[model samples]
Target: MLRGVTHHITATREDGTVFEVSYGYGARQRRLLACLHCDWEEQITYGGTRHKGLDHLAQAHGAVGNPTMTADARARRQVLWTMAICFLISAVILWWATSRT
Candidate 1:
């Protein structure tokens, strides 16, 4: 419910039944999925968000056609590169200290 923190997915069945799925970072950056219609909330331990959303829609409401969505690949790559750079810098520092000793 915080602005820009959660992603919401909604699917409506032929009889106008609504199912809502929300994805967000919970405590310790763990991914979580919540349903608005019932008491069904769980941690996303594996698989993609869209797959889980669509499956929930089908099983609960018999609705379909929610496209498979994924996180931004460019952003993910950027994060990976940043981590690699930090690791390289730490390795160089350790090497220099060892060589001097």
Candidate 2:
């Protein structure tokens, strides 16, 4: 029944991380490929190109603070980095204060 299906995707992880899973099926030899996402994960078989049902790790954990970042993702990483630095500083201060005798 998937003869008309083209490229497809079947997420392998679920964490509300990705926006969508790029999937499509083909009518040829019944092959499929998918760009996995956090909200969906499934097996697919149809006529298509290379494997795709895999995590888009680059978008999820790609480089941060690069001059190329120009969107919300960059903003999100900045906030997270700032928070991490603040937390580290706080931990060090706490250690020093408690160690003082």
Best-fitting candidate, measured by lDDT? 1
In candidate 1, what are the lDDT values of residues 1-101, reduced to their tens digit?
Answer: 21224777666578745466778877777888777776666777887776787678778778653464334433444576898899999999999999996
Against the true structure, what is each candidate's TM-score? Answer: 0.54, 0.35
Stretches of candidate 2 off by over 4 Å are 1-70
Q: Please, what's the RMSD in Å of model 2?
A: 12.1
Model 2, 35-92: lDDT tens digits are: 3333433345443222233334344523122223336444554676898899999999
Report lDDT (Cα) of residue 61, candidate 2.
29
Error of 2 at 72 (Å): 0.3
TM-score of 1: 0.54
Instruction: Tell me how candidate 1 scores on lDDT.
Output: 0.68
Residue 29 accuracy (lDDT) in model 2: 43
The lDDT per prediction is 0.68, 0.43
Cα lDDT, model 2, residue 28: 54
